[model samples]
Target: MSLPSADADWWRNAVVYQVYPRSFADSDGDGIGDLDGVRAHVDHLARLGVDAVWLSPFYPSALADGGYDIDDHRDVAPELGDLAAFDAMTAALHEHGIRVIVDIVPNHTSDRHRWFRAALAAEPGSDERDRYVFRQGRGADGSEPPTDWESDFGGPAWTRLDDGWWYLHLFAPEQPDLNWDRRDVRDDYLETLAFWADRGVDGFRVDVANLLVKDLTEPLPDRAELATRTDGNHAYEDRDAVHEVYAEWRTLFDSYDPPRMAVAEAWVPAHRRARYASPESLGQAFNFDLLTAPWDAETWRRVIEENLDLAAESGSTSTWVLSNHDVIRHPSRYGITAAAGQPNEIGYIPAFGVDPEITVDTALGATRARAATLLMLALPGSAYLYQGEELGLFEVVEIDADKRQDPTFFRTGGERLGRDGCRVPLPWTSAPPSYGFSPEPAAAPPHLPQPAWFADLSLERETDDPTSSLSLYVAALALRRERAAGEGLTWVPAGPGVVHVVRPGGWHCLTNFGPEPVALPEGEVLLASGPLADGLVPADRTVWFREA
Candidate 1:
């Protein structure tokens, strides 16, 4: 079947796959994945039928925050490969009709970046220091942080230097927030966009896109004070000034041949999200409400409706995502419930399953995850698939504490288990140890440990198994490309715990979220996430059909 074309608005309903570079495949046997590794796996992506590949950061980094702390935005990391390797990989993906979207860390730069190093050496208020958000301490002895804002990871956002100066880092201490007010910082980023666009990159995935321009005008509000305010403005996050930066970027992106595209990883409020994807700003913005929603029918329907409505407001298509590098795998996340009848906030759950009040039902989670996939893929807009989720890989909850590397784990003093479990290396073959993740069988272990049960879900084992999650995804994506037509859906009134919606082309999708079978609509079954019983959609299953 022919896939979608790379037209000006190709991303409208595209299925983009995310590759976490370090865990995808290690071509050099260095226990870390590189661009060469990605090049070798192009065929796998082609066979899986993705429209584009959204690559995670592979830029020069100390891996301080798992490559998010980039020292140079223009060059590839020596460990990952050089500019030449990156070009080759990009060419390889395009050869298979897959566009490439690379991550752009415009919000911050690594502390070791040339600009940050210069800022450290230069005296306070110097031009070099102006590239970053550096300020004098506020306390009597200049000992306290300029603001009481807490880092997204943990602790204070400001890291104090020996000179009693402070710099803001919304994430780890190694990643210093850039001063977007500076003309040089903005111009340099524009040049970075041109650099990659010149190198055949199709688009960019803007990291922390909403946090670039902070409102640190004066008297920065503390966390406590901001909590009580009714206004949506903040000292750092989702400020209005950030949209100006993206407007400049939209202009630059429009200059390209096919007109490059971008998706904002903005964690702003639902009302503010569409602003990032406005016609004058970035082309798209991620909607993560579905990722954290519970596996309930009412909640799922509400989130989908809200996302579609918001996207419509901005003249943009909705973006649906189930899992990513930072969060727990959906299969594992679907396994739990709250004892107090409160909704299970999937975002806060730790990797190790350390919360005694919560318990996991593996079988139930897997079933729901498959059902959720059909629901997401059948929706009216774009979708993103995280690596290894095709094989239905569960979170590796038992990694040795010593092997843990997420700074959140350290910053929180192990109270929070962090995201290492979901970042474990992919298993390509049904083998022990490295599991074909490394080119060499005896290559050193993957940076993160893979559970032994991974053998059953390896690509080699699931490639031809029609019942496997990988096979389900392959079939779903193929069918979606051909038959997932229409702009909106009409809700078909159904019994409790059952959701039935019909799309534009007489397409009918029914999902049974309850614990019993439900009557199916009168149509030809095109696909079912799991086996149906007596022509009824089984519990925890989803099915798509159409008029015969």
Candidate 2:
């Protein structure tokens, strides 16, 4: 086999595709996606010009939180495949010069996990119970949860046991939070990372990187208390102790022949997240400010400036992301906004809370979505692409309540719709019986039902049409690889709602976010998110020009 790249610095300005494994491809016709499915589909990523693929949580799990509640870190999910499948998939990806980044759930594990199960069966103060966060109830009869800290998925963060003790779960009850302060817990994850690294995996995408180190000296603090402590201290998030864990991880990452790397899903504030990305820490973190910025040139320009600056200060490359497995697709999110300049805080909000008031204009959303892709890809940093955004897929908000499985939906008593919309199996073909995600029509229906309307956005349709969203993504990614790999960006003066960016290789990207068309620059039209007419870029369009 060919040796891994000697440089080992591939993430700098690289395009990494995020594949929700269950929805990517089904090679076994088992109605669920597996590692062989990824091996079969690496060609799509190669053709799309991505440098790597990040698989989201393919480890053994009960699918309690869609595989995020990992039951086994060293083995693949039974429905997915075995360890041999993972090694084969990694080998195939490396064969095509594409790196493999597996997801690591460090904050918690499924209640069914061996450690958690053993913790439950052991005495309250036993060594096994120290692996996770367990506490006695607060009430006289030990009936109340220890804290009022709510789960990000919904409901209380603490699960009460029949034996008068309670377990802490920052997410769903099925996902019990682990106590990182315990030496065994830290050693366990370190060993898990080494296991994947030894198996030839390139890197990892750490889940909830900010929430690892909790302040166990005090009782669980409420959100009100969490907001007041600003002395560079937090109850569980952005704690100084978290960096100690990453320092250990960094040492392990650097020991590889090619020196592996990791990017943290660290969701600290925009201006102050550099510490988590120090060279001794994770070395990279997701800058989500741009993902939530208003669809205006000024707003986007500022977000881009701050993110790149922060990355530079921390000695790390900026990582840009738009959508992932946890939230609504950007095309749908942009379409529901009323106007270009409207400010929206679009995080992971539930559908049941907002569908009654919001209506999405699919055409408008797709137009802006393509323009945004061009803008993000042209920026001077690494970029992340969710699986279906290339096909211009919208959120599937019409799943029947009985079919919904996200822990958030049930935890909130149906007050929230959860993340099922984003997790629906991808449509590979325009036909029925699991689209082409399954190999045959007779296969069991996909684990989560796919919407029939997904046909229009199927890969078959997108692949056939040259002007489809897939074409734009392929063309833009190729251009980004060929032209926009500089370490800095120079902004030229343009009118309001226009961002004029000049990269290192004399390529210019002009985007018009206002209500009217703008005159194109004096250069050859290399690629445009939409068709150029009369040397003018239409409103909500982006065009890249090769300078003479």
Candidate 3:
């Protein structure tokens, strides 16, 4: 496959800001975000110094699995505006020098999709029906899922369709898994990519990408066996055939000028992540180790080193994230406590006589968070910034039971509440009534409650405040871009929780995820985050040391 010109190192060292359109901005006063709303925010992203914006799925669907379950690959959902709005958004983003990456879910489609509907209607042997994987004879009894593999969201991976055949759904039943084994399925996705690319769309952030292919030979353990041995569901990620599917996609993407990129949502080990980006596969894959790693120095360092090493070997770019739409915020993960001396962890409230509000003594300070942010931005790869992370926005608090929407909560039997808390709308202004997100008055007819913390911490305010998280992110991006840090670089080990390396310009990057401060003999502090007031001493922070 051909590569883009060396001069276009945009994907490397580029900052990608993820926009969850449903909650980012609402232009039509519909209380839900739309393409027009995203169009209006393009300038804001440019102002934030991000190189591009990765939009979540806005495709037509039943909204059962958020937008991941696509019913139509070509049409935009009516609630999110029409195809015209998408074109306008893309053009507007391009004008701002910011690229647009749309989310593509190839593993599955909504049960309501025409293909699935036709498959359901057709007899078992129909050629049109082969577009999906439908299997019979589960076992001697035929009463359980095909395998003991657990779904990422929970529950059995297979669902019995009305036709009495079992269809696999690694996520939700409504989100029926696509039959990648079929040539038609692959061709359809290629055409979908071409359609968007032809429309000037830059690239794609593929959703649940690693599950495109699965092993059909293994039968799921019986329900009783699964219940006793492990979680009774499907393990659909990181399967062997995923590489082939990705290679196919990469080949198609290469045909386009500038080599439109593809980033996979691969929740796998660092090494597996590397394999997914094996040059011939995806351009890059999101690194979740950082997000999942414990909030300790050694864990962080090891994760970073593993990622760097894997990326280097795979000939792929490194990517990192501290938070995303589907998980808890980073602050909460780090154990937010009042005694730690920081703001209250966004996820937890101060329960009287229980857990009090976190103060500077108990909370993770701005410096620590900033340090992590800087390290993520300065790393030798593309970076993904989740919506509202710039302002150190915390996850939504006090979610009412009725308001909770994540399917995981149901599937996991409430063991995990799902990602609804993180998917709440972005609070642009704290004025009142939907926190400046919805246009309606606070106590008006719609009567939507405003996100209080959003008003307290917003891009508008953070942009003005030098100490604000938003400002810190901007500074970090500026430094990364200035150094041309995206160019040829190698990741070398610097002990656990540390990524040590030299860039093409003879600049050394020493980042420590360890709790204890690390003293670098030489190099200026490009950016510091954590409790270090002077930005010199490292605390619970990440700092880049370039030779002075």
| All candidates: TM-score | 0.97, 0.96, 0.85
Off by over 4 Å in 3: 1-7, 137-144, 218-236, 336-362, 365-367, 441-450, 486-526, 530-538, 543-548
lDDT score, candidate 2, position 422:
81
Which 10 consecutive positions of candidate 2 have the poorest summed lDDT? Answer: 338-347
Sorted by lDDT, highest first, which candidate order results? 1, 2, 3
Who is ahead in lDDT, 1 or 3? 1
Candidate 2's residue-wise lDDT over 1-548, tens digit each?
A: 22366758788778999999888888888888888998998888888888989999988888888999988888988888898888888889888888888899999999999999898889888999898888987879888888888999888889987777899898889999999988989998999999999888888899999898888665667689888876358888788788899999999999988778799998788655898778898888888876677688888988888888898899988988888888778887787753343344454454433555566778998899899889888888789988988888887888887988888788887777777888788888898878889888545888788877888889898897989999999999988878875587899899999999899878899999969999898998899999889978999999999886
List lDDT for all candidates, in order.
0.88, 0.85, 0.71
- lDDT per residue (tens digit) for residues 430-513 in model 1: 987888899765457899988889999999999989899999999999999998776687888888898888888888888899
RMSD of 3: 5.0
Q: Indicate the TM-score of model 2.
A: 0.96
Ranking according to TM-score, highest score first? 1, 2, 3
lDDT head-to-head 1 vs 2, winner: 1
